[model samples]
Target chain A: MTFLRDTATIFSREFAPVWRDPLSLVFTMAQPLLFLYLFGPLLENGTDTPGPAWQWFVPGILIMMCLSGPLMAGYFLLLDLIGGSMERLLVTPVSRTALLVGRTLKEFVVLLAQAVLIIGLAVPLGLDPHVPGVLTGLTLLVVFGIGLGGLSFVLAIVSAPGGELFYGVTQVVMFPLLLLSGVLLPVENGPGWLQVAAAVNPVTYVVEAERALFAGRFLDAPVLWGAAAAVVTALLGLHLARRRMARGL
Target chain B: MIHARGLTKTYTLKKTSVDAVRGVDLDVEPGQLVAFLGPNGAGKSTCLRMLTGLLPPTSGTARVAGHDVTTEAAAVRARIGYIGQKGGAGEAFRIGDELVTQGRCYGMTRRAARSRAEELLTVVGLDGMFARKPSTLSGGQRRRLDIALGLMNRPPLLFLDEPSTGLDPASRADIWSHILRLRADHGTTLFLTTHYLEEADAMAERVVVIDQGRIIADGTARRLKADLAGDRLTVTLHDPADVPRAAEIAAGLPGAAGLASDGPRLTLRVAAADRALPEFVRALDAAGLKIDTAESSRPTLDDVFLALTGRTIQDEEA
Candidate 1:
């Protein structure tokens, strides 16, 4: 109970400043919103797979939004390190887990808000995903955010004092994940090697699950695998973050 | 309140090892304020960091506030406050919010934290500035906020690293007053590091001088000055020709060292000015050497450092 309270305190501390900066909040949602409006239309041309353009595009945009939330949240940790605030926090009685999970929790919450905004926009653009389906997709993204945000926080610590390396590595990893996970296009229509790579990407399960939900196909294999992947990622990412914090960042 | 034995820290990078702090043993009774004096890079900061449980010691044992630093760091931290050279307040936070958050980190309730923040602000003389952002504060005001934040947990011991390094004289005095007040009112044990010789001499009851990662001298300022360094006597002869004869007489006196003649002035160091000055003057009178002016000055902390290490403390800092 104390651990949860400590985490909440840290979470509020992180959230308060971001809440005051509406412009930055708008910028966080801008990219995914743009993709939903611009590239989202290009999907209307119809792919080799059977699905409406908006249904396919909505899931991809939601995943894209989730990817950015944690990546950007990592910068806060880097800033804290450079500013000596992390050192101050280290000397306190606050648990290392609370310090890490608190920041990631803020990222997860932001991703959920972004997911809501994207889904709200998608509804007017011909998105017909049902209430349960949309709720499930948002839930998956929240869990995925925890995983990704935790990894981002860890990466920030790993490349501390020189954050450019963090950006470079995240970009290298993120682009590949996006390409292979069928966010831009269905992996089945791609080359054989691409299919094999997509099979290995956990995001593939998320994208597939969300796509099925967008099509109103609930209670399917995709949803189960996606939920499992999200939970595992969240657990693994949080665990690594806590371990790195304990060893000193 | 503090005890450490053979506390040491070594850093190894790319097969090159640098020992920042060599074997150091220290003990301080409760409510005693000891000033750790050293030039930059003298391992003063490293030792403080280890003692406060911020950094792990390479080899040593430290018990602060009844908790082993290595094995029970959280307990040690809970019992001590550390005001680092750089202020720890976050740039974005309002002064009050930062203080409250720090208190909460130490497990204080929200109401308790807020009320304590209010009291500390007044204690540090930052009463009406709670709503201001930390970045908006001047150097001295920001340092005071750092002190208030450190005290949020009401720790028994406090460690301040160069607390008044870059402040103006008035601001430096302000910080010193607040520091003394903390000790007087709460009996908080302070272990601070500084290179300012005069401030340490004037403010600290006990001064520990560190050089090149080793404790070279430790004692009360008066005792150190009287034992290691002596009173300085400068006699200005009416004629430059009298310097040679005066120098000879000064060298002949027992415990009169560092005798030098420049122009019409003859200067030398003596163990005690009150006893040595009278006899030296009578000898000069008998020699028929006219004495224009004679003055004796008490030894400063810098002189004590110079007497022990052959290098002035200020020189090392420069």
Candidate 2:
């Protein structure tokens, strides 16, 4: 009970500034919105994928947001660590897990809101709605995001008091994960090695699952693979980040 | 409310290890304002972090506010407040919201936290600035906000790491007044680290001096000064030729040490300069050595450190 209360406290604190200004949330969504309108139409004639460009590109955009959004969540934690606020929070009686969970919950909320906005905008662009399927796909994306957010927090804690390591690691890791995941383009037409690499990349399974789910193929093999990948990532991210929090910065 | 034994912390890098705090043992009674004094990298912050349950010790044990810092860290954290070296309020958050969040972190209800935040803001003289961000505040105002956040829970003990460092003289005094008032009103046991020798000497009831990761001296500032660094009595001789004889005569005085002579000026340390100055003068006068001038001065805390380590704290800081 206390853990939940502490988590709520942290969540509220993390969310308060966003709730106040809200313009910042729009700025974060700007990049995804740009991709949705401008680059998304470019996929109309270029791809041989089964569905309209909106259906194919929208879920990919949501997955992309899930990737970048939660993966960058640690930057705030890094700021707290560099400042004295993190130390202040650590000295309090608040549960340590609550600290990580609370911040991650805030990231989840923002991701969900942004995902909904992106989906709503893509609907007018001739995207058909798969209500339950999209909801389930969002659930999977959230699970994956929680894990990515957790890993990001671990990176933040490790890079504290200087923060160079956090920036360096995130920059070095984000691009490869995004490109390899096939969120923007299909890897099926690529070389055998590239296909093998995509097969191994957990993000590729998530993107595949998202694309299948958005097209209402809930029972597809990619859905199971993506679910497994999401669950594993969430578990690993939460475990490592929680352990790091327990061990102290 | 605090006790520690054999507390140690060591950082092992690639090929070598540095002992940040080595075998520190400390005890503090309730409501005592003890100043932990040291130069840079003297383990003051490290010790504070351990006692506050923010950092685990490399070895040994500490019980702060009746809970083991390692095993019962939650209990320890609950019973103590720690204001770190940096601004406690997040720059992106409003000061009031941060204080209320701090209160909530300690399990206070939202309503209670809000009221306490308002009350503490007033107490710290930041009453009307609740909605402002920390970055907008002046250095001293930001420090006061940090204190307000630390006091949100009203813990029995508060550990402030260099509370008055880098502040102007007027602001330092203002912070001291708030700290002293907190102790006076609620009997908050303050264990604060400080670089200002005069602040520690004037404000703290007990002083614990750490040097090179070890406690070198701990006592009342008066006791440390009188015991380690005695008063100084200097005399200017009428002739530089009489300096050696004056030094010999000054050395013969009771409780005299650190004797030195340069040219016509002769100086020596004594337990009480009042008693030793006149005796040394009479001896010199009887030896047919005329003295041009004589003066005696009491030693400061810097002198105590110098007497103990052969280097002044200011020199070490430099």
Candidate 3:
């Protein structure tokens, strides 16, 4: 009873800060759009600077979105942590797991909006959204958002100043992940070590999945790998965050 | 219901895990107001956190409401309401919403939550600010809301970490007044920690004093004070800065058995000051020290603390 009640209560209430803060939404969406509009095209259809622009670069862009999603979650969670908001929640008969689940569920709304904006921009840049392409893209975004939300919850725990020092650490960790995910260019041509890191990067799966979506078909290793990655990362992240929440994080 | 036996907490901060709470045993009954008195970082907060299941114990065990703190936390959580030293409610929502959600987490229906919220808002004297965000409320109002949030489920056991820390005198009075009302009305078991000794003296039924990770004394305030009778005296030293010198000056006197410094004031052991006063003064003059002002007075809780811990709580706080 506490778990069900707490999940509903936490989800409904916690979502407000994200929705109500106009600045949070504007700032979160702004930079991603600037890159989409200004730089997204620079890599389009063999600009002669390097290899296949859309083939390699698109996945990285999508992966970057996934990896960075939890950074947003980390920011809000840490405030609540230091502010004693999360500790108060722990005192309740609230469900430990529900705290993060509710958060991930709420972010589905933001994920949908991000997907629409991305697709809207993608169309102007001449990426055709065939029926299957659009459907697969939407599915991937759902998985991506949930996965990111869970990771952010985990990051938020470690980010707790008393525990993990999340702000400085996350900021630094986020950048290299973006570069290695190959959001700006292909990491395939980078050094062997960087190539390995990119390959192992969960965002790479997102990029690969997005590539499949853009091709008007979704199948093979990439889509399965992406979905699997999201599922595993979410479970792991939720597990860690729940431990912290349970132990009074 | 709470029982802790040899409870200890050691926190590992990268290089070292210092023991914050060490070998403490306590037993508390339901609906009693027990005050945890200590200086800052004297393990009061650490012990309270463990009792409420907020921090894991480094060693030993505690049971609250029949649930083991480490193994049965969710059950312990269900049976208790814990308001920490800092205001800990969700700040993004309206106060009414926050209280309602708290109620619902205890398995109450929406209508039930609303009725309960209404009752509590009125109880904490926050009726008009139901619709305002907690982030927008004044400090006193935020603290009131913190109490309301802790009480939403009508928890059988309540833990308040410094229930009064920062507030104007008026607000402190108002908050404590509300707290007394809640205790009378609900008979809720209460445990609170505070650095304010007077607050403890004024409100607490029993006082447990801890210092340097150990329980120095535990008894009713009256009993602790009674233990200090016939031996303590308040006297002035000629100079505040020369307290050490004054201590030696008082110590050499024949009947001055126990002597201690409390800032400019010196307290010494004497069975009857009237019999020993002339000789003590003559010895001070012989020692070439004039009394600025001196009186042998009845013992206070401050003296009680000093007698038990060998250091006053004020010095520990400093």
Candidate No. with top DockQ: 2
Candidate 2 docking classification: high
Task: Give the candidate order by descending TM-score.
Answer: 2, 1, 3
CA displacement after TM-score superposition, residue A71 of candidate 2 (Å): 2.8
Q: Taking the true A–B contacts (Cα pairs closer than 8 Å), what share appears in each candidate?
A: 0.47, 0.91, 0.80
Docking class of 1: medium
- Tell me the tens digit of each residue's lDDT in model 1 across B1-318: 889999998988789999889998889899998999877888998898888877889998999999999899889888888888877887866779888889899999989999999999998889998789888888899989989988999989999988998999999999999999999999999999988889999999999988777899999999898889989899999999888988888887878888888899999988888888888999999999999899999999988888888988677767
- Decide which is better by TM-score, 1 or 2: 2
lDDT of each: 0.86, 0.91, 0.76
Clashing pairs in 3: A59-A207, A159-A166, B31-B189
- Docking level for model 3: medium
Q: Candidate 1, after superposition: displacement of residue B94 in Å?
A: 2.9
Supply the DockQ value of model 3. Answer: 0.56
Question: For residue B2, what is the lDDT in candidate 3?
Answer: 93
Scored against the true structure, residue B56 in model 3 reaches a CA lDDT of 86
lDDT per residue, candidate 3, A198-228, as tens digits?
8888877766666766666566677788778
* TM-score comparison, 1 vs 3, better candidate: 1
The collision pairs in model 2 are: none
lDDT (Cα, tens digit) per residue for candidate 2, span B1-318: 999999999988787999999999999999999999988888999899989988899999999999999999988888999889998888889999999999999999999999999999899999899899998899999999999989888899999999998999999999999999999999999999998999999999999999988999999998898899999998999999888888888889999998888889888889888888888888888999999999999999888888889988888778
Residue A114 in candidate 2 has what lDDT? 92
